[model samples]
Structure formats: structure tokens, C-alpha cells
Target: MGRMKSSNRKKIIGALGDPRIKPYLEASGGNEKDALALYRWSVELTASIQETLGVTEVLLRNSIDVQLRKWNNEQLGHSASWLLESPASPLRSMTKSKRKEALRRAEKSATCRSASHFRHGQAVTHDDVLAHTMFGMWKDILPNHSPGADPEKTENKNRMTLWEDAVKNAFPCAEDPEGEKTYWRVAHLHELRNRVSHMDSLLNVDVLDVTRDAFALVGSIDPVLANWLTGTSTVSAVYGKRPE
Candidate 1:
């Protein structure tokens, strides 16, 4: 019994020791019957501490600001962002058939997702699906430049695609060792955001995996992302926002 107790403590500390806390931490002193509660406490406490420390913004924001050079200087992910955004990539200038196919898949995803919310009186529309899809594809370009030429400036970028706008409003950039993709800032996040916004909705594992991969893509472009995530840097330092 004593050996078992020691082993458990090791597990708890190990779980808590990582810069990213696991699903559970500091709940019931590790003896609670509710693992979910522990997980919730861990996430909540960490989020709280992050904001309280002011270290959260520093790491997430500054890191991305610093790595902006990598996107243009070093080709990250075979320049995946560039490739995807290029007129050559399927996203920017695919054949009509291919574009339709992508849209079809995205539509299905939106429909299925919205239907899941229908019991609560929510409705899905084609426009919603299209907006969600487009957002997922072009979300990374709002901060410094305005695209200068929004083909349809008459169309509201915000209301027309609120889902995309929200993510852009929140995660404007991905600070990492690799420079910013800049291309994907607002778009891809729209896909993930549309599934669940302004709530504590649990995502399906597959969708969770996809979002994680997207996060990974951001990291691949910058080596310093992990450090920034852990509060080692901030946008001020990244943008050279320090006093001389």
C-alpha cells in the first residue's frame, strides 16, 4: 500500500510538472473520486494563474511577433502556408470541380455540426456553412494589412463571417520559433471555432486531433514557440517594444 501511494504521488507531480498541465491537477489532493473535477480544476487554475501572472500574453503574443521573419526568410513546412495560399495551391486557385468538392465536404461538416445543435432551436444556413469554410481557409491576414483589396468590400467581413472574425479577434497570431504563417491566422481557426464558440463544448476526438495538428503547423514554422508558450517571451520583446 505504501509503495502504491508513493507511485501515485510521482504520477501526480509528473503530471503537474509539465509546462502544459494534464487533464487533472491539484484536485482533492489526488485522492478525489472525481477525475473530471481534478481535470477541470487543473485547467481552470492554470488559466487563471496565466492571466494573473501577465505571463500568458507575453509568451503567446511576443513569440509570434519575433518569428514573423521565418515565414519570408526560411521556408517552413515546405512553405505550407505559402503553398496553400498560393494561386497554385488547391485553396487559392483550384479547378471549379475541386473547389466544389472542398465546399461539399465543408458543408457536410457544418450541417452535421449545426444539426447537433438544432434540438436547442438553432438553425443552419448555406451562408453559415460557406462563411465557416472560408474562415477556416483565410483567417490569418487581419492584423497589419487589410488585404487592401477585399474583392467585396461591400460585404461585411465581420458579420458575413463572424466565426472567423472571432478567432482572429482572439488568436491574432501564432508565436513560435518559426515565423508566422500569417496566411492562416484567421481562416483555419474558423473551422475549429464554428464547431463550438463561447461555450465549454467538448469536441469529438477526431476534430480535437485536427485542431491539434493545426496548432502543430503553427509550431513547425517557429522553433521558439514552445518557449514562448511557457512564458519565456512576449510580443513586446518580439516586436522590439522595449525601451532603448
Candidate 2:
């Protein structure tokens, strides 16, 4: 493509907001045209990361869901969905509200999409509710440190017990206790996912390192998925093309 004229660069910068474009400008040594080029590269890099993040999110959620299902069913002594409200369930005190909210949204959507006008019945399924849950919901459920909480605190005990009974098994390859390594890696990618969704700058982000963490997180659940993600990811290629 031809060089972006200065007027066009100014227009682009104005539309994108100076704050958002400032990092690119600095990276390009204050050259407006170069800054625009870097901005375009950032867009491409964000797209690449978003694509991989999509796959990673699904893999992580589904893997964790599977274990939760098994554990929940075992606790209930029957095959039952794990996401429903259960006073005896670990989610009762922790993620119950989130799950309820997500399911409510899913049902609301189903009502809109359905042919029925009555509010009595909707076709929303467990999978629909699961699909509507945010990435943070999955991340928050993982075992994590609570700095000042007593070991017997409800949150602490729930997280530890959940990890032992279910979450850790989600990652067949994770070797760390309580899936600490897996949790942090998922947290890393979750942050990246948020940045991409919010249209934030990737200028200071270690894109390659983040992508590696993404691949490793998927691999932790299943090496086959990791291989697939690595083979298909284009973030590395896009990163290499960043403007000088």
C-alpha cells in the first residue's frame, strides 16, 4: 500500500483517540505515518490473538465443565447438570450468582428467539447457559491463593476441595498441586482476552510470550488441542510483521 498521507494520518489518529495512538507514535519515533502503520499492525496482532483466545477459551471451559459435571453428578448420586442451583454444590457460595445471571441471560435470549409468546417455556439448554458464561467465571472458580483468609474459610476450603475433587482432573497433563500453574496461565490469557475485547493497545504486551502461554494452557488440558492451536495460530506471523 502507498504511504498514508499526513492529513489522513492525523484524521486516523483523531478518530482512534490520541491516548490510544500515543504508544504507536512513540514506537515509530514520532513519525505520524509510521505510527499509523504500527497501529494497523496492532490491529492485525489483536485479531490474531483474539482468534487463538477464542479456541483457548472453549477448550478451557469445556474441559473444566466436563470434570465439574462428573463431580457434581457423583455428589448428587445421579447424572445431573452441574450448573444448576444446588445448595449443597460448591458453587452455592462462590459462583452461584454468576451462573444464575448467565442462565437468566441465556433464557432471556431463548425467549426472544423462540416462536412462543408465552413466558412459560423456553428452549434454553445447559449448553446455552454454559456458552453465555463469561471467561472470568471459569477463571475465578479455579483454586487460587487468598492472602489473609483462614485455611478453613469457606472460599478457601471450597476452592481447594473443588480443585481436588474436580478442577485439577480437567487438565490431564497438569502436574502442579491445585493446578496452580494452569490457573496462572489461564489468568494470563484471560487478561489478554479482555484487552482484545476492549480494543486496548498491545504495544507493551509480550505478544509472543502470551501466545506461548495460551498454547501451553490448551496443552495442559490435552496435547492434541495444544498441537492444533499451535499449528493454526497466526499471532507469531503477525507479530513479526510489526512496523519498525
Candidate 3:
């Protein structure tokens, strides 16, 4: 082993902006060799997480979309973007200002549908609606009245209520009897996905746990899909190679 080139060394140090990596390098007394090793491990771990998260994100979005569509068609008789504004949606329970803001964000996302045409060479389908929308927008509609609130009050009142109604209704089924647990899990995974998508450091995160929770959510939605995802995932192999 020869010494690393000056330019390569500088690049390695510059990439170590993640705060979690600093302490390890400091513990190594600023040794360049150790710093490079730690940096490589960080890069490898981030790559592994990004790969696994890509699969999980798609699975989650698809699962939620499928269930939402089923519920909307069954209850509302139609399942288009207009369903967001339907009386049956939890969005109807938000305060006037909050409801406006949520709709505004959702509209902005809808506008971005043209970008999909440029990329995929096809018009955006109904299934692509959630893909266009941001996770924050979805989470915003979760704070409405409880599952069985009075329809009258739901229209104008914005009282503190059990926030799990959105999740329960969105994924209505016998699989998840209490949707609160699934809601929290999916919410946390959404936050993690945001961080990874923005190229932020995840050195402190338990990537394995996040992956497992994502798979569990998938299973809750569709056991066959979950098993297929598990068979195709490389996350376990990646975790096995973590720095010792």
C-alpha cells in the first residue's frame, strides 16, 4: 500500500462532513489512514441504506396508494385527486387555513406531473398521484378528528383528536387492528427517507431496524408483496459487511 494521492485525501476529508464521523477520526488522533477507512465505511453504509430505502419507499407508497384507492372507490364511488377534497376525507376536518395550505401543497405537487411525462414518456396515472405528492403533505392530513367524529363538526372544527384516523382510514383493513402503530412506523420511515433523499448523514441511525420496520409495514399491507421484497432485498448482506 502506497500513500493516498493528495487530491484523493482532500476529497476524503471534505466528504466527512457528517458529525458522527468526526468523533471516530478524532479518536484516531487525526490519522489519515484511519480517517480514510472510516470515511470508506461511512460511504459504504450510506450507499447500502440508499439502495434499501429506494425499495422500501416504493413499496410503502404503492401499498398506501392501493389501500387508499380501494377505500376511496368503495366509499366515495370515485378515486381521483378530487377525492382529497371529498367530504369523507380526513382533510375535511382540518381548520380552514390548514386545509387551504394542505390543498395548496397538494396542488403544487399535481402541477409537477408534467415532469413525469418528460422522464417516463407517458401521462401520469392515478397510481402516480402519491408519488408526485410529498410525504409531509400526507402527514399533514393525519391530525384531523378521530375515526367516528361527527361529520358536522369535522367540516369546520380543528380540535385535538386522535391523530390516527387518517392512517386507519387510509389503510382500512383487519390486518392492522390499531393503525396507530403502523402510522408511527411509516411516519418515522418517511422522515428517514427525506433525510437520505437529501444526501444527509445517517451514521447514527439503526439502518437495519429501519429496513425491518419498512418490511413489516409492507407485510401489514400485503404478505405476498412483503415476502417478495424480502427475497429480493440485499439489506441483510449489506448489514453483514458493516465496519467491525
- Model 3 weakest lDDT span, ten residues long: 156-165
Please give each candidate's TM-score.
0.24, 0.90, 0.65
Give one digit per residue, the lDDT tens place, for model 1 in 115-197: 45653344434333333333323333232223464534533333223223232233333442112344333233444445333
Reference-based lDDT, residue 127, model 3: 43
Worst 10-residue lDDT window, candidate 2: 113-122
Task: Rank all candidate structures by their TM-score, best first, as comma-separated numbers.
Answer: 2, 3, 1
Model 2 steric clash pairs: none
Clashes of 3: 0
lDDT for every model?
Answer: 0.36, 0.83, 0.57
Tens digit per residue, CA lDDT, model 2, 90-141: 7666788888888899888877764555644656777988888899888788
What root-mean-square deviation over C-alphas does model 3 reach?
Answer: 6.0
Instruction: Report the lDDT of model 1 for residue 225.
Output: 56
**Steric clashes per prediction:** 24, 0, 0
Which is the better candidate, 2 or 3, if ranked by TM-score?
A: 2
* Best candidate, lDDT: 2
The number of the candidate with the highest TM-score is: 2
